[model samples]
Structures are given as C-alpha cells and as structure tokens.
Target: MAETLDILVIGGGINGTGIARDAAGRGLKVLLCEKADLAAATSSASSKLIHGGLRYLEYYEFGLVRKALIERETLLAAAPHIIKPMRFVLPHHRGLRPALLLRLGLFLYDHLGGRKVLPASKGLNLNRHPAGTPLKDEFTRGFEYSDCWVDDARLVVLNALDARERGAEILTRTTCAGARRNGGIWDVELQQADGSRKTYKTRALVNAAGPWVADVLNQVSPHSAKNKRMRLIKGSHIIVDKLFDGDHAYIFQNADGRIIFAIPYQDHFTLIGTTDVAYQGDLDTVSASDEETRYICAAASDYFKRAVVPADVRGTYSGVRPLYDDGSEDAASVTRDYVLNLDTADGAAPLLSVFGGKITTYRKLAEHVMSELQPLLGFSLKPWTARMALPGGDIPNADFDGFCGEMSTRYAWLPQPLLMRLLQAYGTRVDRLLGKAADTADLGEDFGGGLYEAELTYLKDTEWATCAEDVLWRRSKLGLHLPAAAHKKVADWFAKATEIAA
Candidate 1:
C-alpha cells in the first residue's frame, strides 16, 4: 500500500517550490519533484527584476501591476540579502513616449501598490546625473523609479529549503513520468535520473511544471484537463563587460515600442536583455539566437554612448516563458499574470494547473493555490508567508547593511570580498556555513575565485548541489569569475564526492 500525500507538486521552479513551501508549512503532507536542476529553465533566465511590470500599464494591466508591486515589498522584506532595492534610469528618447506620459506612469507605479519602504519615482536630468555619463548626449531627460534586483535562482532554492525544513520531500532530477486517478486519489509514477522509479498516491495534484504544463496534462497525465493553452515566448539576454560605473540600471525604450534593460551584474559585467519572440522549438535546448543577440546589442547601443556589438557579448542565455495564451497579436503583449485552474469533475481528485506566472508574484500565487485547496485538503492555517522571513531573511528590521556589519565583526578573519559574497548568498546562514572555521586555512582547499572546500561541502550536504555546474552557475555565479582550470577542478571534486557517496 502506497502512502497518500496531501499534495504533490510537479516542478521545482519558483512557483512549484513556493507552493510546496506554503503547503508544507500548513502541516500538509507535501512532495515536490523536478525533472532537472532547480531553476534550470525560465525561472533562472529572467530580467531579474522584481517590479510592477511598468510597461504592462500601457496595455491597461493595472491589477497585475498592483499585485506585483505589493509582492515587491513583501519579497524585499522577506529576503533582504538576496533581494535588494534598485533604481532604474529610463532614458527618454525624443522620438518615443512623451515626457508627460512617462511621468504619469511613474506616478501610478509609485502609488499603485501603496508605496512604502522603497523611495518614490522622480524625474532625472541625465545631463547632470551620474547615470547619464554613459548615455548618448541626446538623452538629456529621463525618469528614475524604484524596483528590486533579485538572485532569481537563489530565491527558488531558499523556498525549497524552507519547504524541506518544514517536512516536504523535494526530489530533483526526478520526472513525474505519469499519473492517473483511482478511487479519488492520484497514483503518480516518478522516474529518477538513475533509471529508478517510485510510486506514490496524492490526494491532489498540481501541474506547476512551468514550460511543460501542457505536456504534463496531455502526456504525463493524459486524463487531466487539456483545455488550456500555453504561449511559448523566448526571452534572451546578453552579458558584456561592465558598460558603466554606477550601480543603477538602464531601461531603454526601443523603436519597436519594446523596452530593454542593462543592469549591473556581478560587479564586473553588464547584463542586458531581453527579446520577446514567439517560439516553437526544442524547449530543452533553448539558446539565444544570433538575431536576438544582435537585437539586444543594437537596443543597448541605441542609448549608451559606447556601441554594444555582438562581438562584445561575453555570454548569452535564453528561456521560453510558458505564458497563458490570451490571443494577443504581439508576443510581448501576452499577459505576465498567472492563471490558476482547478478542475474537479465528477468529484474526482482535484487538479490545479498554474500557467503564466512571473517570479515576483510566485509567493502570492502559492498562497492562492493553498487557498483553493483548503476546503479540499482541510487545512486551517492562515496565510503566514508574508509576515514570516524566509530562511536567512530574519535580519532585524530587514536591515541588510546592519546585518553585514554584524557578520563582518563575527567573521573578521575572512576576506572582505569573500565574506560579503557569502553574506549575500546565505545571509544569516553564513554563520552556519562557516561554522567554527576561524580562517582561510580552516576553510580547506581553495578552488580559486573564493570558492573553498567548506562552501562546496555545505552546498553538497545541505543545498543538494550535485554537479560543478550547480555550484558554479546556479548555486552561485562563480563560473563567471573562475578560470576554466578551476571549473575542471570543481567538476573533478564533484565526481569524486559523488563516487564516494555512492
């Protein structure tokens, strides 16, 4: 006899992990499975801004904007270290939107979600502002607004961590092979990466498989509802050597009426993106097209004094956004808001399918999922995520700077740069990761680029990091800093470690 689970979530992206965290916290028997690494797809590939979708206001998406705005502050307070407040400089192109229209949008953005801790938007004289130094001379006027920059991958991992801590079984590299309803319970078969399979029964099933939402319904669970459709939009971004000196990011309005962003990434690089093109290709091997690379470079080159060419691109990434098809003529015009569909035909087990969600609204989406499942699952816990801090996010007053100061004093022996990176990555958990290590010598073998054996062990033992790619790219962007030799060394270390574990 298989044990029955209160909820079984398929997908390990932000939404799936978030829903798992919420359901597990509510005392429900929860299990979440992912086919690949966490945030290996659309969730990791984002503009990386927690904003109100300011441009969506043009299409009259006031509700979506307001919802995201509210979540923006909630997420900031919940994870001060990984999520930080950022100011955006939107340079006004003479031929594009008028000054009054920009001002009106910014005003609504400021007050829409009941603007609190973050500063309000204001007009900028690019001629005098430091952000203007890198911009073309023609762009003299602009608007400055507040949003937040997030480590998108880390956010997903933290949510999963919380869910695990609260008693959720999180399975990575495991695919929900198939599912069927029997006696009002879902019998699910999961296939692991090592060719092993496990079966479980779940009272309710959630198809939060992100890009594969439709596939999960049609192929994985053939009897499930198949009325919904997903619009796959490929958004691509490019990384280049730091284009400007300021911490601020730039929002360039393109001639096609689309917008692009160039944000300061990892201290030494400028992250520019993203193109919205209708995609109908291989989802597993999505990559930036040559055309998208040129498009992004051209878009950024339009505003910056320095020309950004495809030759200047150091790296590129692309992901397909699985959006709910709203029959929009333009790919960029498709809704960023999520749609939750609950199907309970003939009193059978419930199937909740989540479609088209942005990273910023994932938490709220999870809350709504729990709300929908409450009567069916019989859980009485109220919504508690908004007030409670995520894992290491319990810094007093949510003061990241103050927390860093305290950490500096406690771990004074660690290098300033290494300590800051760890503080940013793990927050309060840095103490746990560092443990009783007193100095760099105690940290063990140096893998170069500040990646020590101690941190690798912590990621493997605690964070479920199995491969070097997980440690280098997703867990942290140390791959960008480390040399190729160091990468091979990291890979060798993982191979040996996995062998030892097996």
Candidate 2:
C-alpha cells in the first residue's frame, strides 16, 4: 500500500528541504527524499556566506542583490546559532575597477535591501587598519562591508529537521527512480541506498534536485517540455591555515576581472575559493584539480603580504552549480537568480522544476515555489516560515553569545571549547544531546575532540546521520580537527552500529 501525500519533493539540498519545510508548515502533507545525505552537494560546497552578492552589482543584478541582502537578516533571525555577522575588507586595486565604481557598488549593496540590522559600508585606509597587517604594502586603501557566514551543511540539516517536526517525511539516501502523472496524482517510484524500493503517490511533484534537476525531469517524463536546459558551472574551494588574525574576511580582485574570498573558517583555517570553470563531467566525480588549487593559492598570494602555495592547503571541495542556461558564454556571467519551470500542459498534475538559486535566498525561493503551486495543488494556506524558528534556533531573543554565557554556567563541567562547539552546532538542543550528563565520562565513550557516543546517537536517531562522513563533514566540520586514526575509529563504530541495528 502506498501513502498518498499532498506534495512529494525530490532532492534534499537547501532548496528542497526549505520547500519541504515551507509546505509542511502550510498544513500540506509533504515528503522529501534525497539521493544521499542532505546538503551532500552544492549546498554544502558554498563559499559559506549569506551576503548580497556585492560583485553581482557590477553586472547590474540589482534585483538579485537586493533579494539576497534582505535574506541576510531574515536568515540570521531564523538561525542565529549557525549564522553570524561577518565583515569583509575589499582592497582597492588600480588595475581593476575604479574606487569610485567600487564605492558605488557598496552604496547600492548597503541600501538596496532595506538596510537594517547590519552596519553600512565604509572606506578604509588599510595602512591604519588591523586587517592591513597581512595585506601587501601596495594596497593602501580598501572598502569594508557587512555579510553573514553560515554553517552551510548544518543549515540544510536544520531545515530537514524542521520539516520533519512539522509533519513532513524526510527520507535520506533515497532516490526517485521514476515519476509520472496518473489522473490527479503523481506516482513516484523511489529506490533506497540499500537497493530497496518503495512507491509513493502525491498530488504535486517538485524537482528541487540541485545539480541533478534536469536528469530528474527526464526520468519523470522523458520528452517533456522541460528538458536539457541547465548550465553546469563548477566552483572549487580550498581550505588553508588561518591567513590573518582578525575575525574579518578579505575579498581580492584577480587581474582577470573575477573576485576571490579569503575568509576565516572553523577558527583554525582560512577558506579560499572559488574558480569558475565550465564543467561537463559527472557531478558525483567532481573534485578540485591541481590547476584550481594553484590558481586559488596564487590569487590569494597576490594580495596578502604572506605568500600562499599549494602546501598551505589543508582541504579542498568542489560543487557544480546548475544555473539556468540563458545562452550565457561565461560561467561567472550567468545570473544566480532562480527560475521555476512549471509544466502542467493538457490539464495534468503539476511538476515544478527548480533551476538556478544561491544559498542566501533559499527561503525566499521556497516561499515563491509554494506560491506558484498553491492554486494548482488546491492549497489555500498562507506562508508562515518567515516568522518561524528553525530547529534549535530559538535562542534567547536570538542572542547566541548571551545564550552561550548562560549555557556555560549550566554545564560548567564541560570543557570551554567543547561547550562552545556544542552550543554553536546544536544551540538549545545541546541539552537534549547531553541529557543527564554531569561530566565527560557521563556522555559516553569519547571519540576525541569532544565527539562522544551520545552526540553520534542523537545525530543518527534525529538528524538522519548514518555514517561517519555525515557526522564529521556535514552535520559538523569536526573531521578537520580529529586525528587520522579517529576517522577509522568512527567509521568502525558506525559499521558495528549498523550491524546491531539490523
């Protein structure tokens, strides 16, 4: 027997989970399925910023910039625990765009999106600023602007969690093998990772498959009107040891007219990225090439006083962006705005295919997706996610620092670093993961770096985490801090745990 749902969403990236959460909250019976772990693709491989896309202003993408800028605070209010304010220092280069032009772009970035909460942009004399210590001496002037940094992977997981809590079924490691419109419902065949299969019925079908959107459409309805119209652009990033001491980040302009970001990451590494190249390879096999590595290092070394090389890189990741093929030749020139392609010809059930979106505006994109399908799906509920809090995001008045201070007092026995990490990752839910634990040993066997059996259990039971990679890389970035032997130990634990569960 197949359960009929109001909406069946394919893909578990930010957009998919966001739409699932929105629809579920609107009193719709929604089910979201992901081929792998949530955010195991483009959502997790982002620059990790919630900004107005300041560089987009040069291309006159005023509307996209404004929408993202407005979402900056909207997301901050919703997930204060994982999203925080970040300042960026953009040094002036005589060879690139003029300082006046830069100032004009910043001006638009400052006011385009209601301009509240975050500080306004200002000119800086790099020689007198603390951020200048690591920059080259030739760079004497710069501009400073405001943006927000996010735990990209955790953001996706939190959305899935919220959707699940709101009566949505979140099925991870499950792929939609095929789908078709039957009368007034969609019959979707799903294949699990372990080779099991299930059939589901839904009134509306949503293809929020980030990089695999086009492929999913073809599978659902081969020879459909919406087929083969996605531009696959690969963006690669490298993580190196901290380059500068300040909490602030730097945006450097390359001679080729593109910009790269050097931001402080995970408190111990500097995140540098991303090379824009036309990628026509398999999305599952994408990795950072040696050329992209050297390009990032060379680009950062040009502006910073400290020269960076390949040896400085500690980690690298790559993701392919499925931008709408607007006949654009250059990869970077494509618009980041999202376009919804709804196909309901011949009075059939609707199939909405999402194309082209960034992480910052995923919430707004989800809302728009629901608005488009409300009439077709026969739902009259109003939007409610704007004022709702994501799971564990209801910190006291959205003040993460103050909440941390109070938590430290409550759990004084825990190490300061461990406590801070837990607070940052789980927020108010830390209490749930650490129930009745008074000391380190009470949490269970230690896996090093404050990772214990208890937290792993919570992730497995609640967050749909199945393996060590899901815990180390996505749910958190603790893999970067853990020892090489610890990785094997964690993997062994999951392997044994799976056997026990089976």
Candidate 3:
C-alpha cells in the first residue's frame, strides 16, 4: 500500500516548497512532488530581490507593499545568510518625476509597514554627495532606500530542506500523472524518478504549480474546479559586466512610469532587466528574445552614462509569471499579489490553487494558506515559521559580516574571494558541501568561476540535479561567467555521471 499524506502539493517552486514547510510544521504529514528539479522554473529566474516592489506603489497595491515591507525584516531575521540589505540609488531629473512627488512616495514607503532593521529612505544632493559619482551631470538630487537581496533558488531549496527536516517528504523529478478522489481521501498516482509508477492516498491536494497551475488542475486533479484564465506574462533579464564602481544599485524611472534596476552581481557583473511582455510561448521553453533584450538595453542605457547594447549582455534568462489576470491592458500593470482558490464541496476532497506570487511574499503566503486549510484539517496549529530559520540562514543577529569573519578564520588557507563565494553560496552549510576536504585540490573538478566539484557533488547527491543546466542555470549563475567551452565541460561531465549511474 502507498503511503498516505495529509497534504500532497504539486510543483517545487517557492510557493510549493514554502507551503509544504508550513503545512508539515503544523503536525500534518505532507508530500511535495516536483516534475523537474526544485526551483527549476520562475523561482530561479527572478530579479533576486526580497523587497517591497517600490514601483508597485503607482499601482496602489498598498496591502502588498505593507505585507512585503513587513516581510523585509521578517525574512531577513528568518534567513540572514542568503537575504541581506541592499541600497538603491535613484538619481533624479528636473523634467521627470518632480522631487516632491518622489519624496511623498518614499515617505510612504518608509512608514508603510513595520519598518525596523533596515534604514529609512533619505534624499541626497547628487551633485555634492558621493552616491552621485557615477551618474551624468544633468542628474542632481537622488534618493536611497533599503531592500533585501536573496539567493532565489536556494530559498526554494532551503524551504524544502527545512520541510524535510521537519518530517515532510519532498520528491523531485516526480510527476503527479493523475489524482482521483476516494471518499474523504485523494488517490494520487505519481510517476517516480526511476521510471516507476506508484499510488498515494492524500486527504487534501494543494496546487502550487506556478506557471503550470491550470494544466495540473485540468490534467492531474480528478475533481477539479473551473479557473478563470491565468495571464502568462513573461519577464526577461540580462547580466553584463559591472557598470558602476559602487556597491549600491541604481533604480531608474522610465518615461512610461515603469522602473529599471541595475544591481551589482557576483562581484564582477551587474544584473539588469526585465522587460514585461505578454507571452504565449511554452512555459518551459521561454527564452529572452532579441526584441526584449533591446527593450531592456534601451531602458538601462536611458539612465546610465554608459551605453548598453545586446553585445554587452553576458547572459540572459526569462520566466513567465502566471498572474491572476485582473484585466489589465498592459502586462506591466498586472498585479504581483497572489490569490487562493479553494474547491471544497459537501462530499469531496479539497483542492487549493495558488496564483501570482512574488519571491518576497512566499513565506507569508504559505502561512496564510495553512491558516485557510486549518478548518478543513481540523487542527489548532498556530503559525510558527516567522521566527524559524531556513537551513543555513541561522547567523548571529543575522550577522553575515560576523559569520564571514569567523569563517575566514576557520579557512585561513582558502583565498578570501573563494571563501566568500562558498560562504555566500552555501552559508553555514558549507561544511556539508566540503565534507572533510582540506584544500582547493581536494575538490573534484574546477569548472571555472570558482565552481568546484565538491559543490556539484553536493547538488547531485542532495538536491536532485540531474544535468548541468540544473547546476549552471538554476542552482548557480555560473552560466554567466563560464566560457562556452567550460560550460560544455559540465554538460559532458553530467552525461558521463548519468551513464555511470545507468
């Protein structure tokens, strides 16, 4: 007989993993299945910020802003290693958005939702202040504010890890081929990773499929509800050589009211993006198109003194946001907040579908969802994820600097850059990745860009990375720094490893 579960969740994106953790922590037996590797979708292809989308203010999404603002500190406290504060420099122009209006917006942002750890917004005379050193002469005044940056994919994995540690079963590369309702329980059929089929009995089913949410309901759910069509809007991003000589990021407001961000990435690169376009392509094969690249380049070039063009792009990625279409004409205007749909009739099992979610709001969204499921499950479990740490996120005072200093002392032989890379990549969990290795040579292979064989092995063994793309594109952004030759080397290695396994 197959194992029974209190909840069976589909998809391994942030929402799915986050929900699994929250549900399992509440004395519920949970099973989360992903068709591909965890976070092999939109979770990894994000702008990589755990911030209150300041641009969303114009859309009047105050509730989302407040919730996200509160989460800014909550998440920082929850996971300090991967998420940290970043300052954005917004250079102002005389003709564009007047200073007063901008100040009003910033003022609201500062006081909106319980602001504590992060500093509030401040205005600066760019012509006189050092923050304006890289900007053009025409821009005089500017504003700066704080937001948290996240290791997007790792956040997904961390939640999955935490859930598993808390007695939840997370299955990757396992697809829910079909599911049917039997009495009060759900009979779920899963196609396992090793080409085997099995049955599972689940009381409730949660559909957190993200882009494929509707498809999972139509194809996998035996008892389904009619869903209003989800609008699949694709956002694309590009990485290039570091633009300015500063640690702070730049946020530029376009004439069309949409804003662009150019943030320092991986030390030597700057990450710029994201052109919002209505996408009708296959959700799996979404790629950054030439036109979208030009759009992003134009937006960046408009504000920066340096010219941005297609050739300068080091790497590009794209993700489709399955928004709960609110009938917005412009794709950019579509809401980022999530909505939940629960289908529970008098004599049937419950199916909950999650729509449009941001990386910043995944945890709270999970908590809210479990609360909604509370009555059906007949449990009195209150929220408990607020103060808990995700995997290696536990640092003193969430003090990454202090943690890094301590790590530096421990591994005195490793180069500072190399140490920082591993610390940032794996946080306090580096020991598991490194095993008992003593030095650089002990790591299995070197795939340029400081990507060692030890990290790859850990991913393959623990994280269900079947191929190189899972390692290069999803788990790490080494694809941006690796030469084409080095990139292929990884693919070849993965092929060899698979053949050996077979």
> 399, model 3: CA deviation in Å?
0.8
lDDT of 3 by residue, 155-206 (tens): 8988998899899999999999898878788888899878899888988999
Question: Per-residue alpha-carbon lDDT of model 2 for 1-502, expressed as tens digits?
Answer: 7668999999999999999999999989999999999999999999999999998987788999999999999899889999999999999998888999999989888999997789999999989999889999999999999999999999999999999989999999998988878988899999998999888999899999998998998888777665678888999999999988989999999998789999999899999999898888888988999999999999999998889999888999999898888777878888889989988867788899999999999999999999999888888889888888888899867999999999999999999999999998998999999999999999887999889999999999999999999999999999999998998888998899999999
lDDT of 2: 0.92
Candidate 1 lDDT over 1-502, as tens digits, reads 7679999999999999999999999899999999999888998999889999999999999999999999999999999999999999999898999999999999999999998999999999989999899999999999999999999999999999999999999999999888888868999999999999989999999999998898888864566545357898999999999999988898889999999999999999999999999998999999999999999999998988999999999998898898999999999999989999887767889899999989999999999999999988888999989998898899999999999999899989989999999999999999889889998999899999899999999999888899999999899999999999999999999999989988
Our tally of clashes for model 3 stands at 0
Looking at model 2, the pairs that clash are none
Off by over 4 Å in 2: none
lDDT of 3: 0.87
Query: Model 3, stretches more than 4 Å misplaced?
Result: 220-226
Query: What would the TM-score be for candidate 2 when compared with the true structure?
Result: 0.99
- How close is every model to the real structure, measured as TM-score? 0.99, 0.99, 0.96
lDDT of each: 0.93, 0.92, 0.87
